[model samples]
Target: MKKITLVFLLIILATTSAQALSWAYPFVVWSGNVYEVTTEEVKNSVISKRIGEVKTKPNDTTGNYYGNASNEYPKGTQYFAISDISTDTAIAVRVKKEKYVKAVFVHKASSHWNPYYYFILFVVAVVLFSLLGKKRFH
Candidate 1:
């Protein structure tokens, strides 16, 4: 029983650590301004300009701050200036990091894991509980 409990606790810790995020919230600080992606609108046609790349990682990626780095816009993240074709002025900025992309005009990116991750965790927990129980009984 003790072994099973220990194993279960270990599994929980591993899962939690694996899914830990650098930050939470819909806004990120760039330069000295706070940029937030509130609403998303899909445009049939639009223009984009590559502005720059994220150079530094933030000290604290959790809270809101000014003149600080953003977790979503981590180092190596690519910044793109997005503009609507109907308008000449650039309206939104898109930041792409790894497989995720976040921007004001584009679709919002979810911070939570997909349902599959939860399902996998459930399965692993069930399997561990059964196996550990069997071992204890045997």
Candidate 2:
């Protein structure tokens, strides 16, 4: 029983570590205080349109839009925007919250993309690469 417990504990630790290491790039769009989603997936995200009226809090997940939806989005998110093909007007925004996931994944402009996490990886790679280069000359 002790052995089994130890193995289970190790597995749990590994799983949690993996999840934390794999941070996602979350992206979001909003129009009139509501997330601009669409009935279909919008491959081309919109850019530079009247942002409407943004009153989002610093890290709050909740937002509202002036537009209204019946049964489609009783919660008030516009799904049609996410399905946009020409997605030129799709505004790109990022909020650190799990509730705001449309397709479960999107390349967001978040702090993860910043030069932070992979900085160590980059240095290690460069050192290994340089050592390999020396082998060729030898």
Backbone clashes in each candidate structure, one number apiece? Answer: 0, 18
Instruction: Give per-residue CA lDDT, model 1, range 47-100, as digits (tens).
Output: 365555555444353332323344555555555555543212223435322222
For 47-121, candidate 2 gives per-residue lDDT tens digits of 223222232222222221122211122232323323342234343322222122232222232221223436988
- What is candidate 1's CA lDDT for residue 12? 87
lDDT of 2 at 27: 26
Clashing pairs in 1: none
lDDT against true structure, model 1:
0.48
Off by over 4 Å in 2: 17-32, 39-138
Model 2: worst 10 consecutive residues (lDDT sum): 62-71
**What value does the lDDT take at residue 73 in candidate 2?**
26
